[model samples]
Target: MKQIKIGVFGCNRGGDYFRSLLANNADIVAVCDKDDFWLNKAKKRLGDGVAYYASFDEFIEHPMDAVLLANYFNEHAPFAIRCLEKGIHVLSECTAAGTMAECVQLVRAAEKSKAKYMLCENYPFMKFNREIKRICDSGTLGKILYAEGEYNHPVASSDVAFMRKYKPYAEHWRNYLPRTYYITHSMAPIMYATGANPIRVTALPVFAPFDDSMAISGSHCGDRAAIITTLNDDDSVFKVSGCAGFGAHGNSYRVCGTEGQIENLRGMGTQVMLRYNKWSKPAEMESNNLYDPKWNHKDEALIEKEGHGGGDFLVIQEFLNCILEDKKPPFDVYFATRMSAVAILAHRSLLELGMPYDIPDFRKEEDRVKWESDFLTPFYGPNGEAPTLRCSSHADFTPPEGPMKAYLEAIKTRE
Candidate 1:
């Protein structure tokens, strides 16, 4: 077997990808991290055969066929673009990029690069989601008219304190991202199901009035936000996401078509419902529960012990296959641009008070070039003006009381 040499950036979240890579017996040539704490840990886990580097510049020079970008959610694009420019394939852990400009640059870079780029959105590869996609693609549900996806994550106060403790930098992307920015986990699956991209979006964010978190963390952004999106190729309106401190524990999705519908069960069960017109010529209606099913052995050899319901396994396998076969990944640069643009436009819609914002087709050169100069991000430059709009009320930040403050006092990392 030809061992495809791979390097990974960001070893913390990179663990899952490493495990998946190991399953395929890929040659783990290198790993990189900004922090010595993480880099040292990765070296211990990956062994002496795999090289480690604190600087990405050094790691990029190391021999590798592909790079798994499991870095900061806001900072994948620049690194991925570099890898592609160097003729190294890249599989990005999503949001794809931070700003519209990065999205535009990413698309343009991949278009010119010989190496392939893929957005590793694991949600669509989940057991139920794949089943839904198969059913929809089979035309069993007719035209998918409406769909809903929600990822409401409640970050505990302690977790906030811990993140602040380790990464005390003021501009750390995780600390202050608006609830609306991380909508890809929910939105990507819906896009995958219908093979459609959201054309425009309207966003509304609900500010959390929790006094403890507000007094402790000073998060001006909301605890929950919702975005309604219209698909371009299909007449489907997708209710995409509500995120951050929404006091919710799980994620779920549903799509209703002209003929039928499919939805996951509420609560802590893996039950799902599938309703459709039976394929038989009798024109009969059928309803079936999708649970306790047989295993899908499509990528049996490579994706056996994968994460995200074998999605992590499948996505990496596809990336490898695309590299070997010299084909574009299913979720290539265009798809990444579209998904990232949804959040970008959604946040813009919130700035305009739920007004609709148009999502440009980045596949077009003109549409992309116009956004090339737009470097809007959650973090600000030395100049007082940050991005186009500051999501937080306080431009200057103060560490919150209790644990976060104690961490600041005890161990100061950055900023």
Candidate 2:
């Protein structure tokens, strides 16, 4: 196999992506971040040979074959376009574009440059989701009727460390991102499994008292948003309840089809429930025991040992394999963009107060024009007047005290 040279941007959360790249034994030529502290960390972790750059302009000019974008959630599109323009392959993180215009620009850039681009939608690589895709593809699920996939992460209360480290930037635009703004994690799997793209969306903001709890906890964002999306073939709903201050963290999915339905079991087990209309009764299943049964597989064991539900490893592995073999990553750029575009358009729907919005089919050339000249400016600016990203707030805005304060303080001390 030819050696692959790669550079990574956004070294903080992109740390996992970097670590996974190292584990797969690919050559990491450079790593860059806006934060000088993280850029140094990448240098230290990757050793003296790994080049570190604080300027994106200089970083893109580096002699590398591919760029792995772990940058800000909304900023990936512009950077990805720059890399593609330079003939560098791209693997960008979710929320592909901040606005519709960037989406079309990105697609056009990919086509014009003829470079490989993969959208990093790792949720589909989770063992359960992969198995669900397999089962669905087998035609065992029959014609899909209706389904629901949910990502309910209690990051507010649980991720104290995350809140503290990035708190300075948290008050930036990302903190106040719309509730539906981060919908890719939950919706990608359903789209990946069914091989369908969301055609249109009618979004509803789940504004309740929980929003106040997060604001009180110093979160600058909204509580939740639900999207009722119409897919090309199957009608489905995706809900992202990210009231970070409420409850324990859990992620689950349920897919109901014409012949059967599969649901992930609650609690510690990664179980699924399959009910076939053709059969007399329903049955339950576990994803790990079946498809990616052993987390210790040489290629995947390290992933299981390291990150979110063991998906980190698999996703990077696929990225490496594709680059080395000159093939396409399973979750290619177009696929990743499609999944991410849902969140972008859904947020548009929410901002419009549940207005219906059309989702462009990038696979078709004619559809690209609707958004090409458009740009959705983000809420935050260099001048620091962050736009007010609102959702209905019934949550109480009280500064946390007692154990929670002490806990947050302790984490801050460590940072």
Highest TM-score scorer: 1
**Model 1: residues with Cα > 4 Å off, grouped in runs:** 160-168, 213-220, 242-244, 277-285, 288-290, 298-305, 380-388, 392-415
lDDT tens readout by residue for model 2, 34-111:
787788777778888888888899999889988889877777888999999999998888777776777878888888
TM-score of each: 0.88, 0.85
Reference-based lDDT, residue 261, model 2: 70
After best superposition, candidate 1 residue 300: deviation in angstroms?
A: 5.9
| Candidate achieving the largest lDDT | 1
lDDT of 1 at 348: 71
Itemize residue pairs with steric clashes in candidate 2: 156-244, 209-394, 209-395, 212-395, 259-277, 272-285
Model 1: per-residue lDDT, tens digit, 17-72?
Answer: 88788776777899998877778778778888888888899999998999999887
Report the C-alpha displacement of residue 72, candidate 1, in angstroms: 1.7
